[model samples]
Target: MALELIKGNTAVAEAAMRAGLVSYFGYPITPQTELLEHLSARMPELGRAFVQAESELGAINMVYGAACTGLRTMTSSSSPGVSLMQEGISYISGTELPAVIVDVVRGGPGLGNIAPSQADYTQIVHGGGHGEYHLIVLAPASVQEAVDLTGMAFDLAEKYRMVVCLLLDGFLGQMMEPVVMPDFQPVRTTPPEWAVGSPDSKERVVLTSINIDPPNQEQFNVKMMTRWEEVEKNEVRYKGYYLDDAEYVVIGYGTAGRIALTAVRAAREQGHKIGLLRPISLSPFPTRAVDELADRVKGFLVVEMSNGQMLDDVVSIAARRVPVDFYGRMGGMVPYPDEIANAIIEMIQGEHDVNADGRAKWLAKMRELVGTGE
Candidate 1:
């Protein structure tokens, strides 16, 4: 295939199609509607299934149904829309179905702006739905990354018989980048042994999330835990830059991470020995790598488009070994590279106190930036 300039959502849609996606069920939501629009025309042309459901709730249930046949299936939505699909997401998890979800996150406590925000980090990565189930979540920082991860999302979902999500903020979804997409994969003609409606199995196959018997539910829960352990062992992924010898580290994911790259590079050029750790797999987070960095680095700075959500996660990993500071822009606001650059300079120069209140300190900086000098 040739490299083509593609928008993030279109690239993801096309990548999923070529990855042998058997069905795609989703609703139209900003930053991700392009994905559905592209699949609507492409899926049917390839003789695959494509349904734009009435709502996010309706779409997720449709994905659940398609996945029951052991088919490669998926759905995409923005932040608020994904929230609406929570119930269906939990049901799919309880059923242990392999289905893909694409979340092009927008800003929100409620119907926030159409602009990009990484606030969904905790939502998708931490399993917002009501359940003990775990999702295989991938965060992408570019259109190309989104394309690659979308393909992987399906395989990861099927590989573990668990839900997988491509979690990119609205910025990545709308951005355009050049990418050489992969060729089409072989289609699945037969259902898995556990799936319903398999002709090869003469015996009846019943696929259901309903475990009316408490013991049965408990058994399945234990099985999920074992499978999640496998995921943690095998699926952790991240990208590091300039970390071979660094006094401080900056951590972010998706758009925030992409922007942080600029800040980190600019800081390095100005003689600051800093690096970045961008986690590709948000869930099953790169904990070991983080633990190692905390042991070596003088301090750490966590940046995000949300109000220090992932900061808490990194703080937990650091365990007070070194100071971990936070800088963020929330409610669809994105931080400038210079602002993050300035934050990095501050962290490296300030008292590297182990118990410093980074969020409170960052909040003060934000207040000054937004506050009028009256």
Candidate 2:
């Protein structure tokens, strides 16, 4: 291919299909509904399994059963819908099955509007489901990036035998961008040896999360911890801009990071030694990379569409080695580049230390600009 203009949701769906997605089960929800709608028609057209389950709860279980066969399986939904699927997500994790979950986040604590939000940061990145489990979370800022990540998600899920979430907000899901689609991959129809059915195996294979004895459960948990160490070592990902000689750094992810880039560029033209670090993987968060910046930069500015979710992560990583300021918008609000640029400038001019009240400062700014957003 040639590059084609497409919406983010549709691009991800098509890319997953190309990546040999054999089964999809989901309930429609705003922002992400387009993804389900696209797959509903296409999956069956290709002789793959596609089901519009009765509810989000039902949809996730369908994905779980399909995944037991060790084929490429997935489901997508927005914030509220994802909340409904939490138990199923935990079950898939407990069973150590591979599944890709696309979470196009929307505003919410409960039934919030269909507007874009990053509020689900702690929810998804920190494991919204019950019990001890690790999820590889990938956040993409553009339609092209979302498409690229979609294929990668399936591969990673199987590689780790765990759930992988492709997380982005409504803005990215509904926005249009040009993308170079990936090539179609060979779909696997037969079950893996560890899965429910495998004729070659002499003994019957059983798959379940249940470990009745306490010592047995502890042993299983220890194995998961060892696997997570491998994931942390190999999967940390991030992107940097103008960092070589920069003195001040900004940290963010997904759409927030993309917007921060525009602000950083503007600051560059103004002779400010500022840069941006956008984390592509939220879980195994670029911890060491950020720690290095804490030593290298004069300060760090944390930005987000949520009220300081990722900011807390940066703050903990930086550990007051450098003063960290924050800027954010909540309830589906998105901060403008100029607002972030202004934050960068304030960060440079002020004598604030690591103990500075970032929320208070951000609230002050918000108070002054309440009626000014365009």
Candidate 3:
């Protein structure tokens, strides 16, 4: 495979096509509009279904409809647009329809900015919509990763019969990097038996999120939970760097993780014992790996582009056994590697009281940085 300089969004779009994506429906949103644009030209030329939806709501529902027919389908949008698609996402989850959603997150509380940010960490990973469902969220840190994971998203979605979100920040989406595209797979023309229209089927197939019967719905929920557990057990993915003898660790994902890697390398070169734990699968979250490292490391620092959204997960996995600190730059601010290195150094040199007081102090310091404390 020849390497080509490709933008992250373009890489993702092309990767989806190679993965046999038969249908694509999306509305343009910044940092992600190029993905839809690429698909707009390519999908039509390939005779695949492509639609420039009226709105995000329409796009997601279109995904739902296509997915019901057992076609590999996907939709992409930015943060605000993603918010509008939550209801449809929830519905897709409830029905156990397989589909891919790419969230090229920008700064946001509500239409905050068009720059890169990981603010949607909690929203996409922790369930953006009303439900007990979980999205198999994959956070790619590079353009190559964006390409690889976008291709994998289709397989995972079908394998688990669940929604898969390729969560990337705007920086990753817009940035260009050398990527070797994956080889194409042949598209499946035969619809699965569970699909709405099966030519060999003698009976009609209906897909719906609603189950009026209380006991039946309860049973359905149990089945969903069981499947989720299976996903958690088998699908957790992450990358650990310099953990063998490191006294301090930094945790992050996506663009934040990519930045943290640079910081970790620099800190290592400076004789500061720092390492990185980067989660590739955000939902399963590499909990076991974190727990194992927690026993070895002196303390942990969570770096993100949001107000410690992923920090909560890191803390929980650490289980208060080690002191955990958080540093983030919200609303489109990207942290420099030096700044993150400094944060890690401070964490290592600061108090080691994993007690309530130490935790409180750490929170206080973080709050001060964000100007949320008095």
Candidate 4:
């Protein structure tokens, strides 16, 4: 197929359409409004359902409703908007409904800004909503990756009967790149037996998060945890770059991962044995891979657009086997390749402490570089 230059948001919308998305409900939010706009025109043209919801809450519930009927349903939002949908997301997860949610993350704490940021890492990966539930979070680093992962999100959501999240930075969502779109896959015409509208179903299908009996709720929670374990074992995905002779590894995801790659290459050219580990799935975070690399690498440098949210995960997996350091640019700011390369060099050469002191030092340096006062 010929590649077309498309914005990340448009690519995801197009990919979902081709992947047989039957229903879409979303509210317009910066860095991801294009996705909703694209689907509004495309879905109805294809005779599928599309709704510009009253709000994020309305949108997520609409997704929940569509998904209950065993339809391919999705919603997109930025950080603040996603916050509004958390309750609905939790309900969907508790009910074991399959759905896709795209979070084109921007700067955040509260309506932080519409610019690019990776601040939503903890919210999306760690439960954004209340419950003992896990979301299958796929972090795509590029426009093409966004397209591919969006399709994969739908398939995985159905296969596991869980919510799948496509987490991307706002930069990726707004930027344009060449993407080879996937071929159209046939939509599921026959609903599953558990679906609300299954044909000739004598029993009424009830989907709800409520479990009045304590024992039954405990049992349901156990089942959810068991399924999460399965996902962790089978679904962890990551890409290793120049890891063979690497003495130092840089870990990141989404747009930050892509930038880290450039830094890795630059450091390699400067005769440093630097490598990169990019986590594709944030939920089932490639902990095993990091553990394996910990034995070989001297230390780790975690790069992120947020204030080291994912760095916490890296530190847990590395387990102080090798020192884990961090450099971050929060509030929608992006770090440059040279900045990352320099950090890699510093991590390798400096005999830094692998504790809170080390993190403080690194953060101080980052603040200095970004001209933020202590």
Whole-model Cα lDDT of every candidate shown, in order = 0.91, 0.92, 0.91, 0.91
Q: Model 1 over residues 130-244: C-alpha lDDT tens digits?
A: 9788898899988888888888888899899999989988888898999989889998957887888888777998777888899988998999999999999999999999999
lDDT by residue for model 2 (1-374), tens:
79999999999999999999999999999989999999999999999999999999999999999999999999999999999989999999999999999999998779988999999998888888898898999999888999998998999999999999999999999999999999999999988888888665578988888999989988999999899899999999899999999999999899999999999999999999999999999987899999999997899999999878888888898898888899998888887899899999999998858787676777787778674476
Stretches of candidate 4 off by over 4 Å are 200-202, 356-358, 371-374
Model 3 agreement with the true structure over 117-221: per-residue lDDT tens digits: 999989999998996899999999999998999888999999999999999999999999999999989997677989888786668898999989989999999
Cα-based TM-score, every candidate: 0.97, 0.97, 0.96, 0.97
Model 2 poorest ten-residue lDDT run? 365-374
Clashes of each: 0, 0, 0, 0
Error at 236, model 2, angstroms:
0.8
Model 2 segments more than 4 A misplaced: 367-374
lDDT string for model 4 (88-120, tens) is: 999999999999999999997887998899999
- List RMSD in Å for every model shown: 1.6, 2.0, 1.8, 1.3
- For candidate 1, the clash count comes to 0
